[model samples]
Target: MEQTHSRVAVVTGGSGGIGRAVAERLGADGMNVVVAYSGNTERAAEVVKAVEAAGGRAVAGRADVAEPDEVDALFDTAEREFGGVDVVVNTAGIMILKPLVEFDLDDLDRMHRTNIRGTFVVSRAAARRLRSGGALINFSTSVTRLALPTYSAYAASKGAVDALTLVLARELRGRDITVNAVAPGPTATPLFLDGKPQEVVERMAGQAPLERLGTPDDIATAVAFLAGPARWVNGQVVYVNGGIA
Candidate 1:
């Protein structure tokens, strides 16, 4: 594997939301970054520019996390541009909220494809390619623990992520790589706020002890810890939910 003095990170869904924050935070920490986006080439390019402006090297690539070939190419981009990957943050996922009885199977399948299978594909590549001392960070949700109504399908999908993170962490034993998940609650991102009414958002925000919606930076700070100095932390789901759960 090619190696470099600076650590390198590949952040899926890195064009916006928590993923974009993670990419930018890692770059600000002096790591080379590959910002992978499913669509929105312009936003991805903006992230790359932001990273570079922060005094870090970065490149943006388009990849569908659910597709193995695309994910492989994503990792290849990391290696080609940054030498080697020291961190893999799979923050690419979709959420559809509905009561189980009212949920559409197609939506469930779509969510599973991106949230579960996408994680698996990326984790598989990271397992084989990450250098020693690397970290694999997956995204989950506090809803898995909150068990809120209308979030049945979305919660179920993240529950799988929780399971995957723990098991994969153990499976990567002896590799000196840590696998973990960050579960955020009531984050004020476009994904979480797109359809909710202001009242509903405020109610959920108040559920957390912090009494406000979490900013992307709040979650990214936790990810930065896992990716950089939290070596002793492994196979754990660090909930950055401000005590919501």
Candidate 2:
């Protein structure tokens, strides 16, 4: 039934900063979008409206990325409404910074549940369900490379994501789906800025050669590229961190 038409996308965390931006970006690119938010239906509704205003068809669905049944239902909704799924952008995540020695095990569990476990669940769904020529774009962080203090747990969780992404790319060989992860450094998202102080923010901003924080839209552009045009660029983690290692 998906004949000679625009591709569809499912954007998890569509209510958050980076997720919201990517949804709008893909909408502008003329893809029918399904915005999946774990909570906050109001923010999700706003995203749906913005996507529509951008000239792309969109709807909102509620699903926790870590929950397979919920994500399956989300994909079902996308197909039922937007035709068929072609791109899946998994951006839902959580971060709790602390020294590794003193970090609470519970926090590690929570972060892993959201970041590592969530990626696996959603990527699995995408793998089994996406139409040919589809894409799976997962999120990672430059902290895995930076190895900064208080980021050990976060980095560890994302390291697992990187591993899974690499293997999944090969596992989906011959399927025509490009699986890749985008590792962003010090992005200007509310999730990143929520607890950091001004001095810390400025220091991080200075670390980038661009002398500024990367915006959600910057990351979104990377997602859009991987989602649509970067056909041969698969099984890799594209760092969109302004030349930051």
Candidate 3:
């Protein structure tokens, strides 16, 4: 890999497992990171401290990516404080697992609002304000390809993201911007581990070729590639699943 230079990157949901890893990796890559968190101010602050300790500049802020006004303010804050956004890695996501017949309508709607709508809100802002040669990265999941049981609603939301990434890539063709999605499989995050039995978790991990669940660093490596020095790879969903799907 080439040496990384200083830049600014906005990472959403950046206080949690995957988000924190991506933010730190980008910081290590010499980017000023803006850690966007939805609910955990303390965790977000901790991430900022870690980034700074790694000799990278970073700050934490709150924004529900599903809200347009909040999203606008987030961009404004990044531009106002750290210059401008050179890259955006959207790690914000939600997973509500239940069979289609058993899933409640409110759960489905909330998932869609956060996963689908939130990605759109952030990507739309990025398309308008991202610096030249910048990149916009969205998150999807391996479930879209795996078609796992009880994943219909969640996969549908991410499927929208997969399609939207392609559309946005074409839409930004003349601007030298790259749009892509990172689809991770069975990662060992709180979101992935929550409510699952130990046996079930181990089984999922065993499905991967590496016979282990992914770590935050595993997904962050892919996001870093897309956001910095991988501009030529565009409009695709790169699966970081250890070849499970």
Candidate 4:
């Protein structure tokens, strides 16, 4: 792969899990990175150090993806530090699982606030600021297609993301920017494994023909492709689920 030393990438939720992997991968690909975190300053700092250790430029910025002002500042940090924005990967979201009838409205509201509204806020900024030839990558869930139980609200949010990605791609015609979403399934991240039992994890892992869970690096690889070489792949939801969906 050719090094993209001239490109700049902004990755939200970059402190941990898949977001961290995306940040590190883009930095390794020779892009200057802005690691945006909501709260975890220590972890965000660690990601910045990792990127710099790999001989790439990086900085950590604290921003709530749902807030327009903070997101604006995040883009500003990238521009002020790295020259301009080129790639934006929004991996910031919250997932709450429960049957639709039994789900709490408060939880639903909170999840939508982060998952739906946050994606919109960040994406709107990218649409306005990303340089030509830039890519905007959003996170989605394979459950939207899987139609799995207890994923109604989560699925609904990602469904909205799918719509946003496709529409935005067309809206940017002739601008040379790509808008896309990555829908991952049953990834073995702290966010997915925190409360599930081992048997439940095993069962879901077996659902995929590959018979395993996805790693953060697996999702990161797809994001890196869209961010750099996959220029023709736009306005599409690329499923990286090991064929489970």
What are the models' TM-scores?
Answer: 0.97, 0.98, 0.97, 0.97
lDDT, candidate 4, equals: 0.94
Tell me how far the alpha carbon of residue 51 in candidate 4 is from the true structure, in angstroms, after superposition.
1.4
All models: lDDT?
A: 0.91, 0.95, 0.92, 0.94
Compose the digit string of candidate 2's lDDT tens values, residues 1-245.
Answer: 23387989999999999999999999999999999999899999999999999889999999989999999999999989977899999999999999989999999999999999999999999999999999999999999989999999999999999999999999998899999999999999998998999999999999999999999999999999999889899999999999888
Following a full C-alpha superposition, what root-mean-square deviation does model 1 have from the true structure? 1.8
- Runs of candidate 4 with Cα error greater than 4 angstroms are 1-5
lDDT, residue 123, model 1 = 92
lDDT of 1 at 18: 92
Query: If ranked by lDDT, best first, what sequence of candidates would result?
Result: 2, 4, 3, 1
Colliding pairs, model 3: none
Q: Ten consecutive residues with minimal summed lDDT in candidate 1?
A: 1-10
Off by over 4 Å in 1: 1-4
| lDDT for residue 207 in candidate 1, whole number 0-100 | 85
Per-residue CA lDDT of model 3 for 13-94, tens digit only, reads 9999999999989888889999999998899999999888877899888999999899888888888888888899999989
Q: RMSD in angstroms, all models? A: 1.8, 1.5, 1.9, 1.7
Best by TM-score: 2
